[model samples]
Structures are given as C-alpha cells and as structure tokens.
Target: MKKITNAFRLTLSLILIAVVFSGCLIREVEQPATVKTGGEFQVKLTITDKTADANAHYGAVCVLAPDDWEFVSGSYDSQVGTGIFLFDSSAKPVYGNIDSVLAPPAGMKWIKLLSDAAFTNPADVIHEATINLKVGQKTGDYNIGYFTTKNSADLLGSLNMSDEDNDNAWSDTSMNHKVTVELAVGVEDEKVVPTKFSLDQNYPNPFNPETTIRYSLPVSGYTTLKVYDILGKEIAVLVNGSKQAGQHSVQFSANNLQLTSGIYFYELRVGDSSASDKSEFSEFKETKKMILTK
Candidate 1:
C-alpha cells in the first residue's frame, strides 16, 4: 500500500511540472529588423504551441514611435477603446467594442492593441501589424513596446505598458518586452520624390466645348499618353513618340469627335533601356477628369 501511494504522488508531481513547462513555451515576438520613415513596416506577434491547449486571450501588441515621429496609418486586429486598433489573420482592420480613441497623442504617434477572444489550443498563431511612421531626417535613438494578455480580463493592462521597466511587467500586467532601436547617419534622411516628370490636370474641368492637358519630361525617351472614357475605352491619343525631356504640352479639342459629358482617364508609359551602357528611363503617368457640360 505504501509503495502504490508513493508511485501515485510521483506521477502527480511530474504532471504538474510538465504543465508549467508547456505554458512557458509560448512563441517569442519580434520587431522588424529595418524600417524607413514614411514607409510600411511589418510587426509580427507569434504564439507557438503544439498541444493546441496553450491559448492566449485578450491579446494585444503596440508600437510606440519616438517623440519626433508621427503615425500615418496602421493595420490593426481588434479595437477596444480609442488609441487601440485590431487586426485579424487576413490582416484586415476591425473596430472592437471600444469606440473612443483611447490614447490621443499630445504631439506624437502612439498605437495600441486590444482583444477579448479566448484561446483553446496550442497552435502557432501569428498576428501581423503594419504601421507607417514619419520620422525626421536626423539620426537618433528610439524605443518600441510589446504587450499581450495571458487571459481575457487583463486586456487593458496589456495595452498600457510603455515604461522602461516594471519588474518586467507591462501596463496590461503581461510580460513586458521593450526593445531599443538606433537610427544611423544618412539612413532616415534620404528622401525619394518623383522628379523629371510632371503631369498636369486639364484646364476648365467642366467644359462646354474644349480643354487642354500638359506634361513635362526631364530627359529624352519614347513616351505615350492616351485618354480613356469612364468605361476604360480609348478616346484620344494625346502624344505618342520619342521626344526629348524638358517641358511639353498637348491640347485635346473636343469639337472634332462625338463626345459625351462624363469623366476620363489617361496614362503614360516609358520603355526600358536597350543597352547596359545607357541608364533606363523613368516613367510617370497621371489621370485627370474632364466634363463636357454641353
């Protein structure tokens, strides 16, 4: 009887140890290796489990930009309150039970995450979030915060962790994983704005008889610009030839053709370089709407 009782006690102890070890084996979350100002960066939160029994509920993650940065757009999973945004497996933004924007920036960008779903199994679940931030040209130091809930009731606390340390605890009472990012010289300052090409809007938007269109080029190349109706049907060819870049204009007179009073679109295409010695020509195209009030 004593031997049987000892065996039972040992089995119970081993089972408890295994359960604790399994819980701590959740997948590690990681931030992007590189990101650019005014560009999109992917942030992933991965939860790995093999038993399908290890689940997380009311999970959330947020990226806090530096004081000089600003938030442009984001892909969130679920929204609990004001400053929070939510996203799903398909990466679509969805507003949750919360309505008011929780944390409005006094002068900078801030993002938050909130959810209430209960996890039932141990499976690797990945939550991908995209955020566009505008950073200054100067190099500096920045910090990012990651938070999540172990259970549903603590969702709000998980959304508020931002400080350096709370015994490694976040605002959501979850494990806090704070990361520091460094900005290098000449890394974030370079800007790329389209140059050497300009497409202008048509004059007299709502015209009774005619209107004019204009475009400019910086170098010589084969260029083509054509106009199309709302149905994408070709209507007029404005310019089609190899011409030197600098400045050029085209006038589309509506009197000659059978016309309708509606919207129109246009596009321009530049061909590739034929030889390695020559630089490839850049292409620029834009569309403008015209109205025939007649």
Candidate 2:
C-alpha cells in the first residue's frame, strides 16, 4: 500500500460530507386540478435545504411536461424565497435546446429550473417560486414529474452531464401531481354555462405583436375590455358594448397600434353603462396582467 498524505485524507472526508448533507429536495408541489384547453396555469414549487450545517452550493428543479405544453416566461425568477439565490432561466444549459439536450420522452420534455437562491447558513431553509405554462389543444389527464439535484457535483450548466439523461432521470412519477385539460368549447356550446364570472390568464404571455384575452360572463350585460400601460395610461379599447351570457374572447394586437414593449394591464368592466351610478351599475370589474414583448 502507498502512503497517503494528511491533506488527501481531509479532502476526501469533506467530499463525503457534502454528498451526504447536500440536502436539497423538492418539499412540495402544487398544481391545478383542471385547466381549460389552451389556457394558462401555474405550478408552485417548495424546495427545502435540510442539513445540520449549511454549505454554499446550488440546486435545481426539473419539471417533466408534455411537449405540447409551452413554457411561458413569467415570475418564476422574481419571487424566490428569502435567502435563496437569484432564480434565472437564462443560465439554463443550452446544448441545443432543452428537449434535445435532456431527451425527456417521445411526447414530453423536461423543463429545468435553477436559482441564485441559496440555503447557506442554518439548515432547513426553503425556497418557493411559480412556473407558468400554457396547455395545447389536447385534452386529457397528464402526470407531471419533478426531479431535483443538489450538492456542488452536478450544478446546472455542468458540461459533465451525459447523454443518458432522459425520462428515466425524472423520478417520483407516482407522486400524483396531475393536471387535466378539458376541451375548450366556446359560447357556441350553450349547454355549458359559466357558474361564476371569471377571467383566464392570457396564453403565450410576454407575447409579441398579438395575444388573446378570455373572459367568462355568468349573466350578460354591456361590457367593456380595455388595455392600459404600466403607468395606468389607457392604451387600447378591445371590446365595448357586448352581450350574451357565455364565454368570450378578444384579440389584442399590439403590432397594429405600434405600441412599445412593456407590462400592460387589461380591465374587464361588465354591466350597464346607461345606469346613473357607474359603480353600482357594474356587476363585476376585474383586471389582470400581461406582458408585451416588442
């Protein structure tokens, strides 16, 4: 046997400790039970860093979803939990797109999430964020799987990752995190009436040129849908003087208006404008956010 240096032994011990205590794991995942076809939904993820003592390291979360579902860039990076690294997808490993790089499955893809968020210091620290995505025309029940990696050994963008990472890499399929997409039937499907007033999030957000805004009306009256800039400045009026008690959609085209790219708000005022008191006349008033990418 060859003589081993003291430095070598100490270094080996540290590596083993990291592998054992690199406690980064997804603690919980929240997803919607049902979403309309071609509608947008969000996934809330809670990740915990559990260790006796903390080490300065990084972690990542990968979501397994069908290829038909589009990943819409939204606030996943903005609302990272306290003491977490700055979450950013721009740092994603780009070995020729995520699908070809991770090779999820025949009909699905792997969406990897990373953070500047850290759990350094006392153990048991956690991080939270929401991922936005849009469903396609397909309507069916689907399972969403999650995979996590901790420790400094396999940081995201690590060139060392091999080609073997695929559907097999995403685990815990039985966790039962599933989303069901129902067929989208418009107002033409008169059999189905909306139980309550609601406004769905815009799909393909951070959209350039055009995007569609959808709203539901339990009881019909006069309605007006208008777009406003971040400054509360009125931008465009997409709809006015509407009727019918059913789902409705309006297309907003920024290209035609020559509007610059920025965050915009859309307000839905449903009720009667002919009434003396405008506030009391309105049955419902709701507003939602959408991003414009010129």
Candidate 3:
C-alpha cells in the first residue's frame, strides 16, 4: 500500500508540528478605560505564540492609586525590554519579543510604557502606557490597574478582564493582555470661597517692608483684619478670630511697626449677624491698598 501511504503522510506532519508548538497567546494593545483628572493615560499588554515557537516575557506593570490622587515625582520609563535583538544566523527563528515595565511609588509619577517592543506582532503590534494624576481638592471617583508575568505562568489568574470603574480585574495569558482605568471627580471650583466682601492687593507691590493683604468673608462671621498707616491710625491687627468659609491668608509682619515708607491700608470686618439666617450668612466690609518700599 505504498508503504502504508508514505507512513500516513509522515504521521500527519509530526502531528501538525506538535499542534503548532504548543500554547501561550496574550492580547491587549492599548486598553484604556478613561483618564482625565490631571491628564495623561495609556495601557497596553501583549504576548503571542500560536506557533511562533518560544519567546514571550513580561514582568512589571503594577499601577494602583486612589486617595485623592498623587503620583507626580520622578516618573519611570521602559519600552518593552530596552532594545537590541535581531537574529537569523542559521534559522534561529523564535522572534516575538515585547517588554514594557514601570513602577511609580513614593509620590507616584512613572508614565510611559504601553509597549516599546515585545515579541512584536499583534496584527502589527502597537505600544502605549502612561500615567500621571494630580487633581484632588476633594471631589469623587478614581481607580487604576496593571499586573502580569510569563514563562513561569501567573497571568494574573487566567485572564478575562473587567473594570467599568476601577477595582483590579485581571488578565494575562502569556500575552493575552488587558487593561482598565477610570477617574471622574469634578467640582473643585478653584476653591477660594468668599464671593462678595473684597480686599486683595498686597503682593510684592512695591513691598520691601512686607506685604500680603487679602480678605473675603461671606458667611461664618466674627472676623477682623487691620493694618493702616497712610493717616488711618491702626497699625497692626492682622486678624481677630472666627473664619470658615474658604479662602484665608494672613501674614503682614512689618517688623514691629516703625513706619517710614509710603501708602498702606488694609481693613476687613464682618460681625453683623454672623451670617445666621437661611442666607447661609452674609455680612462683610473691605478695603485694600498697599505700598511700603524701604
């Protein structure tokens, strides 16, 4: 029978080359959920080998933040294994290298690593991984992600991935990649309450004897800040007490008051009803103008 039909076609071509060189196939080229608190975000994970035969390594991609947001320090960097690798001496085919690692702690600020070159070949492969957050004046929502390893297996327990908000889902199959990030907490309003009562103008303005007079009281009353010299009398008070509406700054050390420069005036008072009615309170007075160069 022609030697058993050529030994059954060489045993089905070595069993289809051992089922295409076994397993290991990760995927996830830039998985961004959404990022916009301080701006800057990126994510990408990939590992393949349907039959490329050997070559896929990844270790280091851990990002987790939520506590007002703060990670702006040194900033790390790594685009898939540092570079330099091209072989073909005699059919050493095992190409498919990709690596991207980053670690940002102690203030956080390591942005850049979505893939610079790992096993490259994700239908063409692409890379991107960035992180930078600093928007917290008390608002709301936030979450982050990242974690993976290969060759020794730990693909973050199987790999399916899911994150609508931010909680650490999981994904890793040698390189089946996956990512998630969400940050939504608005309404900072620039802070600085004190909508009406005005009095601001005393910063370095011809200041040599000291300057810094700002005032604004709209509600929580019982306040007072004084400083006068251009024929107004009162030479020092700074602040009296009670103050809690937002925006407050006091520092006018004129060195015990000697008097020798030019114009200077700063006054602010609030103590009518102490803001009690349903109006949340509103009783303020203002006055500003400073210039004391000596």
Candidate 4:
C-alpha cells in the first residue's frame, strides 16, 4: 500500500508541472520599417506560446504609440472578440472585471486593443493582431509598446508603466518595434522661403493678341502687374493682390482691349499692405517690353 501511494503522489506532481509550463507565452511585433509623414501604416503582433497549450488564449493587448501619432482602426479576429477599444495620449484602464472598453486614466495617453472572444489555437505557430495607424508630421524614429492580457484588466502592468520607459520595457526581448518616418515627397521644409525677387519677360513677345507674364517674389507681400503703352499710359491692371513668396504667372488677353497693334510694357510691383490701407509694391518695380500685331 505504501508503494502505491508514492507512485500516485509522483504522478500528481508531474501533472502540475506540465500545466504551469504550458502557459508560458511571448509577444512579437512586426511593423513597417519606414513610412512618410501623414502616411498610413500597419502594425502586426504575433503571440507565440512556448508551452504549446491548445487551451491557452489572450483577450487583450496594450500598445504604446509614439508622439503625434493617432490610433486608426485595428484588424478584428472573429474567433477572439467582436469589438476593440481605441485610446490616444490620455487613457486609464480599470484593473478588474473589464468586460467592455475601459477608459484610460485622466491625463494618461495610451492605446489599448481588445478582442471580445479570445486568441487561441496554440497548434498554429502564432496568433496575430493587426492595427492601422496614422503617422504625424514629425520625422524621426519612433517606438511602439506591446503587452498581453487575459481580459480588460492590467495584463502586464502596462497601465503603471511610463511612456518614457515603455519602449525600453521590451528591449531585452525581441519584441521591440521601431518605425521610421521622413518628410512626404514634394512637401517643402517650413523653414525655407524665397530669397530674391525677379520678373521674367513675357513669352511670345513681339506679336500676338495674348501673352503670358511670369514673376517671382522674395517675400510674401502685395504685388501688382500692370500693362502700359510705350507712351507711359496705363492700359490695364493685370494683377493686383497679395501673393506668397514664390514664383507666379498671369495670362493677359488683349481680345477685350480696344487698342491697335503696337509695343507694350508690363511692370511688376511689390509692397507691404496694411489692413486699413491697400499698399502697393510700386517702389520695387520691374518692366519688360512686348510687341503685339494684328
């Protein structure tokens, strides 16, 4: 009888060890290596079970986002849950009995993704969760935070973790993900502006009912384009308005003007205009001559 009891006790101990070992799991995050400012990108999370338990499952995942980024939507797993919770810079979670979406703490900004059902299928290599995000206008390397949970509760003490330490929390493991951003194509740097002002001669000069006038402004100010006869008489005001510091063009049609074919001069002027007064750039004037024929 003593021998039988010893054998039974040993068997029970081994069974408990197997159960504990089967619950070991780790999270891996995959995301785009780089993205452009204001562009949308995808982040993928793969959860791997070291224990290979068919019954192991997770209900939620909490992620920390970089500054200037916002949560878009996330991929939904019907096998897991029906809906997900969206959080920004300010979020607080309830530690217990998280059935639905829980708001983050006041002044705490975080992003929590939830599933109604639960992620399972340990037989598969991994379970996946994908989230969409929008990149902000800043350019630099950004880090993302990852954590696992059973329900809406604090699964990995993520709520208590600070944003500064969140990215480094998983650095020891291979679960860290960094996203790189650059300025979008064709988007000029905010610090750059025009440096010199100049005007180009009209094209198709010397003979035509219509001509094109081009000019450049070194600074943002009021500008005007006037057409005058060779005798110094103002024939028409082609352009009179505020213009940004850049190259601009205006097309002039002589079809409506009641003038015979002759040589004409076009002038460009720039100045600072006040709200109470319509100023002119007359002090800074440039002229180019063109000819028109019937």
How does residue 127 of candidate 1 score in lDDT?
40
Q: lDDT of each structure? A: 0.40, 0.53, 0.39, 0.49
* lDDT of candidate 4 at residue 123, scale 0 to 100: 35
Pairs with backbone N, CA or C atoms under 3 Å apart (clashes), candidate 2: 84-117, 84-118, 85-116, 85-117, 85-118, 86-116, 86-117
Per-residue C-alpha lDDT of model 1 across residues 1-294, encoded as one tens digit per residue: 000012111000000000001121223333444444333233333322222343344444344444554433333231221111332322312322111323323432334433323344434333433333344333333334333333333223323333222222322212222222334335323333224576654554445677666566666667778888889899888877776755566777778788877666766655433434322435555554555567
Model 4 CA lDDT for position 18:
5
Candidate 3 C-alpha error for residue 15, in Å: 64
Q: What is the lDDT of residue 217 in candidate 1?
A: 68
Which runs of model 4 end up more than 4 angstroms from their true locations?
Answer: 1-24, 49-58, 76-91, 95-109, 118-125, 152-154, 157-175, 187-294
After superposing candidate 3, which stretches have Cα over 4 Å from the reference?
A: 1-188, 192-202, 205-212, 216-218, 222-224, 229-232, 235-244, 248-259, 262-291
Model 3 lDDT per residue over 1-294, tens place: 000011111000000000001122233333333334443232333333232223554323333443444432111123322321111122111212211122323333322122212442222122222223343333233333343322223333433233221112223222212222334445453353645665544555556766666555656667878888878999898887677766677778677678787777787876754445423223666665566768
User: Pick by TM-score: which candidate is best?
Assistant: 2
Of the pair 1 and 4, which is ahead by lDDT? 4
Indicate the worst ten consecutive residues by lDDT in candidate 1: 10-19
How much is the lDDT of residue 235 in candidate 4? Answer: 93
Which 10-residue span in candidate 4 carries the lowest summed lDDT? 11-20
lDDT (Cα, tens digit) per residue for candidate 4, span 1-294? 000011111000000000001122334444566677775555555544332334534344454454466655444333333333323222444333222323222222345544433444443244455555655676766544444444423333332222232322211112234455777775453224546686655654444688777677877778889999989999999888888887788988888788788778888888875444556354367776676778
Considering summed lDDT, which 10 consecutive residues are worst modelled in model 2? 10-19
C-alpha-based local distance difference test score of model 2? 0.53
Ordered list by lDDT, greatest first:
2, 4, 1, 3
